[model samples]
Target: MIRPKWTPVAWLADRMAVLVLGLIAGFLVGLSFAGDGRILPAATTVASTDGPAPSPVPPAPPVAAQGVDGPIPPQVTARMRRGGVLRVGVFGDSFGNGIWDALYRQLPTSDGYEVLKFAKEATGFTRYRTLDLEKRAYEQLARDPVDAVVISFGANDAQAVYDDGHLYPLMGDGWKRVIGQRVDRFVAAARSTGAVVYWVGLPVIRDPQLDADMQAMDGFYEAHMRRLGVPFVDSRPLTLGADGKYTAYLPDSKTGRPVLMRTGDGLHMIGIGYQRLTSGVAADLRRYAARVRQAAGRPAPTPTGEPR
Candidate 1:
């Protein structure tokens, strides 16, 4: 890669690119939808001290006030498993990828669930020009045909944004408006397909500024989801310690020894960490599956076409 001179204007331009690319990868590896899958939201706020004693093995998703705002829409619940099996498509950035991994296992195929990954692509509302999530959503759902959607993004979104050829600070009104519109459109596209959509809020971060930005991102998404009647999943409590603070290492469920839950980059998590972080998402998916079975009055989920 050719290095650009760090002149004032060049440095500013480079930072702009960083925001669009999530500040991690050298190139954009957008999430694939309308063809393949993945989804996302953003987060931050980390505590330096060793967090308090670990909470229960898997904390229940937050009640409406904290973790969630409303229940899954009834219309979606009614038709989610129309063909017997419920097909769920997950989307977002790296965290979305982890959540998909956990959900795929939590809601196994034998139980009449097919969890397709939508996170393979590195895309989000911030990457509006790199990929069109809303359009891909329609195309992807039409091809893969899922009855439910799960999305977690914004981890790499605490940066700048673009609108009408103008650059906007991460938290600027223009950025929020653009990102919110993007969130609404992408989610609406998913809902239009009659799928129950859930937006997983940003998880705890180890950085102060980033975490604050992510908190704002969470509120933005939660408000949008609530407005559209899509269920919103809060991720903070799932990762926060008993004292309601961020901790990168939590005691292992079995050994009770502190285990690293976050990556060196302060963005990603290991399998064990993902297990802790995604517990709520896994729960929500299972609950929906059970509802489908009960509503169908079936002994077992016939879940469409033998669990893809």
Candidate 2:
């Protein structure tokens, strides 16, 4: 066969390009598939702690006082008064990457709240059922009595399977039921520690189907948390783009551009991505912190204690 003069070079280049593309595609697939095959191990740390424990029941703070008008919300006011050591249990899989670390750095040095994390991406409620990392954290926090506990881990669970090994239905079905069960267990575990529960909703995903599943889970948890009187933070609105999907692979809020939320593999967020996410979370925490102060009638100080 007569070959063109550039055929050899072109063929080599083509092969190399295919090889690179294949590797990249494989990585993306791996990231999406990570933890899908393995059921998150059940959490087994539910053993109750001993001795006199602080009040686990988050009491309604005094109603905004008799006539004092504060910028803080009622919940914030209540939280401020009860403030002591805030032991936060950040729970989830890779979704939690940079979550705790970022929050740790952003926390106010003067807030006096001690934060603790119990997050591990790829692990879900199914894992918690047996392993119960949150329960362990609760017991740990109870040793010193943490004022609040923040739970964030829905990216994996939104499309995850239950203990029975059934994939949650495409719409609403056994999957929702199992997910609800998982959430219930998680809430109960965290609340049992007497720490006020703060559940974070799933943020938007790039994929449409995943985004829908995430919203469904978020809605279910939001309603459940409200009904149970637990505090729930919805992160979707903050992360969604004009198309109404997760826009940041790595986000640049200032420029409104997708910087790099996920790693090159698309499973984890890079440092910058985590930083941005934590910024949003920190803002929410600041808002909640203000609420705690107002509710508790405590004086407001800078969250970072030195001008944002």
Candidate 3:
């Protein structure tokens, strides 16, 4: 058999055919992988020590719910009545500022709510020597009577406490009792002024160890708040992913858009995160106020003044 003349034109034609076939094969392979739910590896940048590191993966969306339960006392209802000046005193560490600021901004203008901020950074129930929150609360209460009190501590409480020159490890036996006593005293002092108490729980932290510590602290708050009949607002479910781990970002509860919720430090919250948290708190407060009105045999007044 005589081979075809190996001319330049023929050689070029063969090469083009091979290239076309290779292209088709590559396209089909990519399509097959796509059908199998496979995707091209995304490019990631290595973080430098000079600046903050970015999140490795996008966080899952937050679940919808608030952490409020039980009935609102009649007295609390009366105090939180609509159209009255709802004197609210907020006390806690830096975390409290996020929620308090959001709450203050979102408070209903018609409700006539007055918020007094008393959040001191790096302060907690355990830091008695450094800052006595219980004493500060008492003094503030005595000076100005508040109708409701909002408290959010525990971020700074996950450390050793010094008592009589002896230091106790955080979450230890002695630490638990001392912190519990302080919390009890603070709650009692707020209640003495006929103010309803709302204790916000710590949210999930970015660091694994810190998240674990926060979870433990939340348990303490839950138990104590339950015993005292104060509303305990657990923020874990809101800030946690479906895997029950801490997430830096969560979807906007209203808009369904992804929003960076936590800060780079992983301990504090950004504005969007704080807004999401306080929105739930405000909603729960409104519900409690409505329940109070109902329990008092006074139906909620219609906005239009028409009988429902």
Off by over 4 Å in 2: 1-85, 128-130, 133-138, 158-172, 243-246, 249-258, 271-308
Which lDDT tens digits does candidate 1 get at residues 71-96? Answer: 44555455554656678898888777
lDDT of candidates 1 onward, in order: 0.63, 0.50, 0.63
Candidate 3 structure lDDT:
0.63
- Please state the error at residue 17 of candidate 3 in Å: 65
Better of 1 and 2 by lDDT: 1
**1-38 per-residue lDDT for model 3 (tens digits):** 66567674765575344334434432332222100111
Ranking of all candidate structures by their TM-score, best first: 1, 3, 2
TM-score of 1: 0.70
- Give all TM-scores, in the order shown: 0.70, 0.57, 0.68
